[model samples]
Target: MPVPEPALSVRGVSHAFGRVQALDNVSLSVAPGSFTALLGVNGAGKTTLFSLITRLYDNVSGEIRVFGHDVRRRPGPALAALGVVFQSRALDRDLTVRQNLAYHAALHGLTRAQTWARTEGLVDRVGLTEQIDTPVSALSGGQARRAEIARALLHAPHLLLLDEATVGLDVRSRREVLGTVRELVAEENVGVLWATHLFDEIAPEDDAVVLHRGRVLATGTARDIARGGDLASAFLDMTGLEPAEGRL
Candidate 1:
């Protein structure tokens, strides 16, 4: 049987900023309904790759395709098929939760009725139904983060990109968001690319790609990459860095 084409395909993608090379010939693919994690340390080009995928910054070489559509040549359609939750919260603090979601839906060209239905569904899914009308500034950090995730889903994108999404989140909040993401992958058949340094955020069955010094050092299932070692130690070994004291 022929292998199905990946929902997201990055081919020979490389990026640089003047004298500094942020990514060197990085390439990977996300299969349909797959949950893939990109693990790397600070300045490992993870953010650069994400920026190129989302077209936040244009790369000088290589190709990025979302669901077989090239991102640079067909940005609008490619972007429409993607849902992004950036490292920085992109919500309007002054807006009510519902209002923020409505704006996002509008940006995606959803009708008012469609927007309302999708907003209600996402709010319930993310467990923010009770705070639907509350101002973002009035919500707690976790609540705001949930709201942000819900907002990202307003357009029902096929590919979901989350960048350092669990940062500053308590365990309960982290679990809540991650669980919702997993559910989205299973139920909605969305491809998920979760970028973070923390291995605990990933499931054993999740696919992992390790980036070090602007290059992809390894790609495989999380358990396979770890191979009886803890993820932190495996990462350190692959990147040629010393493990922190007390870490297995």
Candidate 2:
């Protein structure tokens, strides 16, 4: 059988900041409906890669394509096909959950009727139905994070890019958000590029790319990289870092 085209593609992409080369010929692809994790340490150029893909920054070299459309040549369509959930909260703390979603919907060119329908579905999906009318500042941290996810989905994007999305959440909230992401991929057929450092965030069967020093060190199923041990240890080994000398 012929291979299916990737939903998102990055080829020979590289970027720089002054004397520091952030990305050095980095390349990867996200298959349709697949949940691919981008694993890296702090300042490993993960955020730089995200910025390039989202067109937040223009790279001087290489190609970025979304669903076969080149991001550099056709930015509008490429961006329209993507939904981004940044690490930081982007919602207005003073706005009601519903209102914040409405603003996002408007930006995505959704009509009033479509916005309301999408908002209701997302609010329910993210388990925020009860707090839909409450101001964002009144919600807990987890609730705010869920709201951000809901807002990102306002356009029904084909690809979702999450950057450290579960960083500060408690265990319960983290699982809740991750569960929502899994359901989205399974049900909506949306591809995901989840950038995170936590091993728990990657399911055993998921495909992942280990990035270190602005390069892809390994890419395969989590089990393949783990090689019978846990992913955290495998990751440490690949990055040339030794595990701490203490038992868990």
Q: By lDDT, who's the top model here?
A: 2
Per-residue lDDT of model 2, residues 1-248, tens digit only: 98877889999999999889899999899999999999887678889999999899997799999998898999989989999998788899999999999999888889999998899999999999999999999998889989999998889998999998988899999999999998999999999999987787888799899888788989999999999998988888778765542111
Candidate 1 C-alpha lDDT tens digits along 1-248? 98876878988988889889899999999998999999887788888898999999996799999988899999998999999998878899999999999999989999999998899889999999999999999998788888988988899888999988888899898888889999999999989999888778888899999988799998999999998887887888788876652122
lDDT for model 2, on a 0 to 1 scale?
0.90
- Clashing pairs in model 1, backbone N/Cα/C closer than 3 A: none
For model 1, give the RMSD to the true fold. Answer: 1.8
Point out where model 2 deviates above 4 Å: 244-248
lDDT of 1 at 143: 86
C-alpha TM-scores of all predictions: 0.95, 0.95
- Per-candidate clashes, comma-separated: 0, 0
**lDDT to native, each model:** 0.88, 0.90
- The Cα error of candidate 1 at residue 51, in Å, is 1.1
lDDT for position 70 in model 2: 90
Compute the lDDT for candidate 1: 0.88
lDDT measured at residue 90 in model 1 versus the true structure, 0 to 100: 89
